[model samples]
Target: MTQGAATPLPTPKERRRLRESRSLTQAQVATKVGVTRETVRSWESGRTTPRGRKAEAYARLLSQLAEPAESAEPAEPAELAESTAPVEPSGPAGTTGPTEPAEPELVGAGAPARTPARKNRRAPSPARPARRRTPRREPAPSERPGTPPEAFDALYAHCAPYLVRQTYLLTGRRALARESVERAFQLAWERWPEVAVDPDPAGWVRAAAYEYAMSPWHRLRRAHRVPEAPPADPEDRKLLDALLSLPPAYRRTLLLYDGVGLNLPETAAETEASTPAAANRVLHAREAVAEQLPGLAVPEQLHQRLTELAGSEKLDAPRSTTVRSGGEKRTRFWTRAAIAVTVLIVGATALTVRVAPTKYEPVPAPGAPISGVPPLTGPQHMTEHDRKLRQRLRAELSGGPQRLAPVAE
Candidate 1:
């Protein structure tokens, strides 16, 4: 038997728009489609496409959704047809106009229909060349609508507690986990200019916390050298041990991918690794964990377990105000220290200049001995005069007046 041609799906963006327009949640869609929400998310993200029977079902659902719009307005069918028509090149010979916007997955039975872009545009004249448009620059963090401080506080309040729990899983030490998350936020606050503008601010903080939690330097600390008390439950203890047993990279990759529910590309990006490497790490970590606890062989089970393990512990994050204040204090201390060092260097330089020799000096020539002077000698080398004196002294011992008269003579 011959199979029918496959349905042409809408762009990823259109797929998402259709669902949102219908006021449907990903979970509701997942339940209807007999797939997980993550699968639906991946489909909408354009990371993966639906295949075979699911594709047909999805296409039919989207057709039904578009059908209402078509039935509601007599004039919409033409626009819908134009939306589906293959985009024609309207620019120079080598270039083409922009393609359809990214869309979400389809949900119904018939072939998927193309959805129009957010704004309607007339076909460009074939004679007119398409000009290159410079991309619009995003506003700086400070330039954003609300107060930056408030934005930062909001971000901290939302992410800190979750990060602490995640860090605990990464390090298997509750105190260190809390410390890692707090330190991460402090660093984030310090670099708020950069962190505030990031597409994934929470991820920026998470990466920092993960890096700090897994740092080799932590191993040198006396407290970190000793393991923390295991979870009270044997299952949790076993799972935690298994996670700790994996290499730091693998453990982090697994957590980001499975536990945190990030897609493969997002996980890889956060881990600073290539997608393939992240995949390998996740696979290896999963195998290792499953070997230890056979019941957690599935990714879903592992995710649930990680959540339970992290939630069971009392890993509380410091207040946003505390983190902000601490960061400010650290910044001030470093600034002061830098200034003091600069002053000290200048003082030392001034002192060196004050004591340094101003001009070159030459050594004096040694004195020459007098040509006619007799050579100096010890008592053993005395001349005839010295011997005669010694004899006169010996004879003078007879009388003091005689010796004095003789000496005068």
Candidate 2:
């Protein structure tokens, strides 16, 4: 019915090939997807499928150079649903032929030549039950966001406040928490695909916020004055103090699992630890937090307290923006340059110590007998009187005359 219809949209494989044909790296694709380069690789390799907001982003980028996805049309012979038998196409007289497109003549041709009429066809088999499990997790139909970018925005908004709140409780500083949320959102935007598709997107950002706030890089930044901290609630203050008391690993695990509401496996993946280790960290951290609480704190109560502290604090991610590739590249270049400079400075300091260059004049070799007495360690063989006489005679010869002082008798 249409002559100028657009070509069909490229498949994911075709999309990746087109991207590569343009000499674009996975990083470039990731920037558009708001995810890291690795996620792009995963998509291309079929390790993961895009869904939710990620699917939208991917579709948009691919669409820029692609055609519209195919529209509904007559089913082809090979792919047609098997509810009905197939029609045989006309070729030459008395000659079998393959199926062909429906033509006005073929519509009524040869009484709709049916699929090779089989003699005594067997009874149709019953439909198989749906598989209980699939190799890969399909996006939950109910959980999927109705809109594409809306999902990304909704997640950003939802996680922002909690991230800020959680980070604030962790650091006891509102400004720092804000900074953590800002950084986490920026990361989430850059890695939007990965975060959005994650089973627990909220947990991802929460963990990221805490990690940002607790980074060793912030050790020196802690002394700066924050505009606010947790209110004068004893519970909040006590929990913060107790949390900071545990080792960093333990602290992070506890917050991710209990405070951020992540499952133990999710917590382990986020913290980059083994499940057993994460479990242990949570166990010990809970014990430590329990000891610090005012009353007999059970597991449930501890979680409740932590949640309260995190909830009471709030970090509003005021912006959901993605920095440009140029900016990120520039920043990365400078970072690498700074690291190189630091390495050079350290290496120079260690390898090339400054030592005072000493003046090393060679001692004058003893020449023809110096017309002076060889005294002390030079020659113990000569007597003191002989040495004095020689010294006196030498002085007399060098100088025209010398006043002879009375010698000690």
Q: Give the best candidate by lDDT.
A: 1
Output the worst ten-in-a-row residue range by lDDT, candidate 2.
Answer: 104-113
On residues 24-91, what C-alpha lDDT tens digit does candidate 2 reach at each position?
57799999789988888778656787777777767777765332211211111221112112244555
How close to the true structure is residue 334 of candidate 2, measured as C-alpha lDDT?
83
Model 1 Cα shift for residue 81 (angstroms)? 35
Model 1, range 40-60, lDDT digits (tens) per residue? 888877899999888877777
Task: For each candidate in the order shown, give its overall lDDT on alpha carbons.
Answer: 0.69, 0.57
Off by over 4 Å in 1: 1-145, 361-409
TM-score of each: 0.57, 0.43
Residue 231 C-alpha lDDT in model 1 = 91
